[model samples]
Target chain A: MTMTRIEVSKTYKLFINGAFPRTESGRSWPITGKAGDTFAHLCLASRKDLRDAIEAARAAQPKWQAATAYNRGQILYRMAEMMEGKRDELAQAISAVPNGPLAPARTKSAKRPASRTSSLRLSVSPSLSPAAEVSAAIDRLVYYAGWCDKYAQVLGCHNPVAGPYYNFTVPEATGVVAAVAPDQLPLLGLISLLAPALVPGNSTVVIASNTNPVPAAVLGEVFATSDLPAGVVNILTGKRDELLPHLAPHRDIDAIFAAGLSASEAQMLREGVAENLKRVQIHDVAAIAAGEQGQSLEHIRGGVEFKTIWHPALA
Target chain B: MTWRSPTVDTVMVGERAASFTKRSIKNATKRELLTLALSMLDLTTLEGKDSPEKVRGLCHKAMRPFERDEQMLGVRLPSCGAVCVYPSLVPTCVEALGTSRKVNIASVATGFPSGQYPLEIRLQDVRDAVNAGADEIDMVISRGQFLAGKFDEVAEEIRAVKRACQREDGSYAHLKVILETGELETLDNVRLASDIAIQAMDDVTPSGTGDGNIDFIKTSTGKVQPAATMAVTLVMLESIRDWYLKTGKLVGMKPAGGIRSAKQAVHYLVMVHEVMGPLHAGPGGSNPWLTPHYFRFGASTLCNDILRQLVRLKTGKYVAGYDFSEA
Candidate 1:
């Protein structure tokens, strides 16, 4: 008879307001693998947890938005560096998911475009190797990091009006944003959704992928180790349906990025968003994963509000 | 005469306070505790930019905390215990809370947040606030004197301020001597200051004056860190409990600053119940120390948090920060 020692596993908790607090309700659900073996016990967050995250994001957004754009770019780049440092851990977590390595696309275009605004040729799909996915995520972060301080120059405009005025439209972060991660490509999907929202200095409260949340929970360390200020990117692990309804109608949340919501879930979110007139965006994650939906300025603009200022043209 | 201050074990005080946070409060019981905590708040605004308009806004908030969302919910929310402001701003609060005697007017005097001024001026500050229709005066003690081991001078100053809290017609305004525990440096100093204030107020206050006894012993001025930690408040509450045991007069306890949430406020309440419950039982086996007359929260933002909780309980929807106006 051979004796084997059991491996110790870490429990995942909700990240809110700069702290990893267990769910105030003290509820936990087992996250199972393909063979029906429990991988970990993730916190089953309640509505109160959602409320607390929103409050933290709202409180932190103003200060985050006030930072200089160059500084914001530096922090996003630091996140990319943190992700780079934790490559092996993230790859292992992503590969552990069942059916994680689907039919791998044979293309190897995981390189940064020579020109800014040139299309990124990332081989993003379920079959993409975990290393390639993590590589794409880091490059994608750097791609947005290069855009953070420069987006305003491209998106902003000085309009020629009939009157003597300095009329210009500038972009400002829409206060607090809520992002829902996709289940299939947890690591890449989370990074894609979060990079654009954070590029323009918006603080986000993310609902991590329910089925494969270890990748997202692993990214919590990425966020903490990076210089991203506390509460800028809070992550919660729970059932999407249980958390989405509360995040949808929250008046403090200015915009919601709920990817892969079903037709019914979409309708429910739209109805809830109407209560506060919040900006809601639903994305096709599969299309993005197939190299079709690489993030651009529009995804960045989606998390921002345009401010048109008219100053008197004085000599 | 020689003087002695009771010995305080910081480790014991901290351990006792930490035990209270472990008590489980939930569902209906949690909601009830939140409601009780809301009623004990001294909605404060002691800023250098204090204005009559600001004080009036705070008074309105103190009186009707959930006014913005009351009609939609069809539930009546309770008013806080008092509107606390600067001495010159007491008239504004008094006029703002006019005819609504349910909310008392409290003023922070004695060179508030920092008690560095001379005794005569400090006492005059207390007198001016009381004359301006303030029913309670929150006076800061001389931390410099207390730290220098001049316990006699510290005690005498509290007595003089208590005397100053008396009005012309023999009616007394309640006095709350602030220890500014953050500046006291150590838990032993915190305990000694609390003991000195309690003894001084007890000596000056007539025995068994019913509701007119030396009103409260407060924790901080809200301008310092380490303000109103459970350990500091536990030491103060223990001092009050001991005084009550000796003189049979219940003294209220107030922990101000850095206590912004309903959870922290309820923990303070639990500590009070465990420490002072036996001596201060009200009707229906309830701890009388939980009420505003025997306990109060010196807070500015706590009212809105409690209002949000109340509205959330009434309607299943959580209220946003914008739903409640600033105090």
Candidate 2:
């Protein structure tokens, strides 16, 4: 008799309130690798988890916003440094899936494999290696980290009014933000959406990619080891369709940044946003993939609210 | 008074109290509990900055937690147990509540939050509050005496305050002696202090006025850090249970201070129902401890949180903080 070797798969959990906890609902779904092998199990979060994350974000937002912009910049830079250290690990997770950052789009004429095991060895050309995506994500975070302190100067303005008033408008964090990551370029896409939101000192509850979630789950390990405060950024891995209904209508969420939403899903989200008038920012997945989107200061500005202060210049 | 304080297992008391919070209360019972918890609040304002204006605001909030939505929610927003204030501010609250018999006026006296004054002054403090039309007088027992093992002295002082609550017309203001258990330190001392206070005031000279004997035993003055913790409250409730079993006189329990959320208020109700249910159920099989008369919350912010939950349940929408007026 021959003994078969068994591989130990990773157990991925929802990172909430600074702790890695299983979903309160006790439900999970399997994430299959490109080779059709089960890679990991991701926590299927519930509405209650979303509520808890919002509460944690609300509790931590004030202190985070109170921190000097320079300190926030330093923290973001540290996160980039952490990502650099975990470069190899992140690249491996992203490359595990065929529909990931490194892989080219699957064509209709591609040859089909006879067996599921042999399908893992499909002949596919690389568009970009997983290392490039991870490197781009780090560079993107560093870019946002530099913007953390400088955006205020760029976005804020000294208003010219008719009175003897020294009037100026400054940007402030828009409380708790909710972001949904795109499935393609899971790690880099998440960083692109999340970094801009955090640069303005806003706390966020992010939903990692539903299809390619291993890289996002791995990023949670970096978030934990980094000096980022607990609850500053929470990460959950699950079906976007299942989580959005709960996330959209949450009264405490100040804004939402989602990618690749269907028209109906966008409409449904808009209706939910109508209840609280939450700021909604949706990105085109294809544009983001083609590097045509998400490098602007508009993403940071979307996560911030403006306040104008006036002082008597005469006095 | 031969009733002696038993040695309390602090570990056991803590474990038992924690078990009460774990009991899952579902829709029907949860709604009922929330409403009852709302009614049990002693909507309080005890700061040095309290004035007629703040007391008036609190009184109005006590009457109408959600001015328009209370009726829309289809639940009669039964006024809270009382508006608790300083003796000087009681008259202002009384005037603010004005002709509405639904709410009572409770005044804290006896060097409240701290019983450091001379005995004569503390007694006069109780008398002045009663004269100010306080339906209930919350007096703090002298922890200095209680901690000194002067058990007899502590019992005598409670009796004095109880006597001071009496009116010339044979009606008495309901007396609620606060143990200030946070200062009592250990669970044993809390149990002992509760025993002494209950035993000293259980002699109910039947008043047709319903101003029963030592109407309630409160846990704190809300000024202490560890005010009215569940572990301490359990020991006190257990004392009430023992006193009732021995003499058949049901004494009320008030766990005041630090109980802010609606969820916590529900947990306290659960403890009351389970601890006092077997002995003190009313004629209709209702848990008698569910009423403001038998059980009360000495809280300031709890009512608004309860109102928020009530609105959510009825309107299916969570209300913003600004939706309700500041109390």
Candidate 3:
């Protein structure tokens, strides 16, 4: 008689300091499908996990920032290349969610031009299908990859001084950055939140989408193989509300970029600015998914510190 | 005096040591453990490039540890147990530490890291450090002599070093014998070295002088690979326990080097508590071995990590290494 084989299941762990580790709290929550069938388990990251990630980010930030801008661009492009190789698996994880982008009967809307005004809506506007979202996420990475070396040139400018001195302003990375991804379009939202801060050389610790974190966890695998330095980008999968309070008041986190937060959640993040005077940038999920608004020079500029220097005008 | 050192079960010792790390230390218990571990630190700087200014800075850090301890944790932290340095820097530590003496000054003498010098020079090294105002003297054993079956010579050298720790005031500077177990090659050798060192110190301790300071059997000199492993430390702790059981005398244990994390320090404390019993189980209502007086960690990088953990426990937020002083 032939025996039936047991299906092997995968455990989704947090990506911290470039390695996958179970939460120190040893707690886990389930990711259930539409019919309430549990498919996988993800670590319920605690405040300590956030703390550990920040330590790693702080340690890696200097060397990463010191790397030439062209080199950072190459690494970012590598991320996109790795993502393309895993496109099928990423699409599967995204479509596995209940009523996700791949649900039948979803109308395929005509592509909208990237704009800041249309992205201002708070509601969940019609999003692309799973395949399109995955492709868009990959493209978004490539988009930032090109900006890594050029963002400084476009954002910086020579100053007009009233003296015989040459002066100019350049943007510098704002140290470690903490981010929150949107619940809708998990992969696309994460890439949108990550690429801008990362392109500018700011190390990031991002809380993945609470409702659909499978894609973000899988993206960690891509990051590990992309030659991206460990701690450059750490991903945590747990309840956003539970992590926001800890993320906001963190003194080590130089800035915060969050998308798709409610009024109270946004308030929680803003209130923490008083503790460390960290920069807080909040955006809508729909806006982040709208490529034009999400991928822009201004987004990269938000997480940087502008430094002005003066030198003798004489040769 | 002849000694019979029992053989160690390497697998059993490793398994037992691994089990201590699995203890779920959390909440108030974790906070208490972190603070206790902080108090047991022997902030050390034994470098060839060590300067007077550097030793002074280390002494300052040893006394205060964190500048804003009371402001952040609402509890003033106890100063570190001692500051270990080269004998030449003993006077520098003395001046920087001032007369408050909250942090004792410990000096590594007898050709530390490697004890290759002649017996007379090594003993003189201990005397000079003790006279230079060091409250403790850390000496290294000649691994070559012990490994070559010359146990008697090794024991005689340790006894000579202990004698040199004596001062004009009749009180002796505490002696810590570094086994340099990394060179011992096996758990059995580590056990034998620990036993020989403890017995030699006990022999010269002057019986009925409960007033004599406690001596230590340390694991390494922070200069070798695999300086202090859990298994090696457990074997030494068991040796100390066996000595205590047979003679009713307390011998301190110091595991120097390679202990850089707060978690690892706590594991060492757990082994001490389990193998030797609770802190107050001894004859005088307290086990000095469990206290900083009998136990110490010769680790310099571990202080900031412990301070960071303590701050996290207090503020519910994680802090960065840059926030603390580099000393």
Candidate 4:
């Protein structure tokens, strides 16, 4: 019961929408780590963190689509009990790997600080976690938050009520996502790309991982201290070949996640997403480093609905 | 009765250019040996299992310049060099090719194409590809003593893998002597194993093995699929144009395995300009470091279908697929 080690990053700077400032392109670099305790200078995520992550994803897109899918699956199962009460400062902030783990205080101070910063001891292995990789990425968005009440009952199709009236197949919301992440587990691959487009209610902007942008601006200060209805997961950080051609040709970005690139950078992210035929996915950053984090939630396209719920049949 | 109306462009450029008359090396036609036996659908024999990073990710999707959508049906065949792998992948084939596209890393030794090793494990696979940086060594001549005829124990195990490719950092490599043209089945033993591999690249003794040993004579090592042809590269480009007209020096000529694509690299550059003429068409025009020592297309999906036909003409997007997802 003796928690003490703090030099928690010497006045770093770059968070963006949840505010840390000082980068609006005035540069400032270094973060070093393997614990020679570096973090020097830091900044660099401007064009105003892509206009404050697209105006905090257009001012938290209608209160993250009016919150309730059972209170957004209890705020994503209370972000897995706030990532199991900070599993050792998220495994000493992403440990690159070496013996400094299997913790008995990193295997007894890894046989006494034996040189070259033992890849700064990050193996939070009780079977790996940074909050169990954001609690298996929000128990994988509460198993797609229990398929937003049964994935439109066995994935859509049922409509021939012609005269009486009652159509079907509904799981919409394929709008505004933008993602880039995958710079090697920088905040669990940017929470497996902002939890499948903010747990299906959409609104995202994520650029993150220009070699770990200060642990993704400390996950935008843990989604601006949770109840995330503001900008449903905007992220930002720095340089995805300079913010993926403004979110792969953004016309208010309908879809783009991109992920790793190569097969000629995924054919230039399918020709920088030929304007608005935009919805590109590509993703395979080695299949999200082989766990395929629910492969970008079946390419999240809840963008298909026909809810014509009108009741005026002569009372 | 003169055969003297002999051209008009200097009577068809003065009678002959040189060696264009066994009625022109029987002018190839059986529809050019069925387009050289359909260059065996652009041959891609990898034998590459147990990953050298899946053979350097099939050598960076067969020497970069990529695309291949259809389940990676991989035919990128332009990478006609390097890819003899295993020497912990000689810096994954010198970091997967492209520095003015040279590419020939070969390393096979006596054990290859069954010469059955133990000349100090074929001089430790040619001194482990000249200490992991091979540019060619491909041994193999003890087809159990050239099928028991023992041409002096296959020219002293190609002079001890060309004396374990002579190091002391003058770094000589090109040795290649795999005449398993399916066990030398006569073009009179493939012109005496192409004259003892062009007399071991014109010896410069100390029991000579490296002055870049035998820069070219490789006929087969795709472990014998009709071990390299065009009648063994027209009897090894007529023993390298009769050892460059009796030793004026020009020595390369590599006819490797079922020569795969870009129309079998223009049907072996039209059979090296129809057998030794337009300056013995060696990678065309005398020699540009002699195109990895005179042409080689030992395929692995013809360098992934010439990098998926230069990425379907630089991303005009026609993705069909050819393997890069072992799902």
CAPRI rating of model 3? medium
Q: Tens digit of lDDT per residue, candidate 1, span B1-327?
A: 346668888888889999999998876777778878888989998888988888889888888877755585575767899888889998888788987478999899998878889889988999999998999999999988988888899999998998898899877898898999999999888878887887787677666456465468899999988888999999888888887777767778889999898888889988888887876446676677878888899888887787777677766676678878897
Candidate 1 chain B lowest-lDDT run of ten: B205-214
Clashing pairs in 2: none
Candidate 3 ranges with C-alpha deviation above 4 Å: A1-9, A34-39, A99-126, A156-170, A307-315, B278-284
For candidate 3, lDDT tens digit of each residue in A139-168? 999999999999999999999999989999
lDDT over C-alpha atoms for residue A27 of model 4: 82
Ranking by DockQ: 3, 1, 2, 4
Clashes of each: 0, 0, 0, 37
TM for every model, in the order presented, reads 0.88, 0.89, 0.91, 0.34
Per-candidate RMSD, Å: 6.3, 6.4, 4.9, 22.4
Write the residue-wise lDDT of candidate 1 on A1-315 in tens digits: 888989877777788887889988899978776667876788888888888888899889989999999999999999999999999989987777664333222233333245511222223445568898899889889989989999999989999987879999999998889998876678888888888899788999998876688888888888888888899999888788788878765767889886555545666777888887889887666655655366788889898888999999975
Q: lDDT score of model 1?
A: 0.82
lDDT of 2 by residue, A121-169 (tens): 2233324568998988898889899999999999999999999899999
Error of 1 at B116 (Å): 2.4
Candidate-wise lDDT, in order? 0.82, 0.82, 0.86, 0.55
Candidate 1 regions with alpha-carbon error over 4 angstroms:
A1-49, A100-127, A159-162, B1-6, B185-189, B211-214, B280-286
Q: Find the candidate with the highest lDDT and give its number.
A: 3
CAPRI verdict (incorrect, acceptable, medium, high) for model 4: incorrect
DockQ (0 to 1) for model 2: 0.23
Give every collision pair in model 1: none
Error of 3 at A149 (Å): 2.1
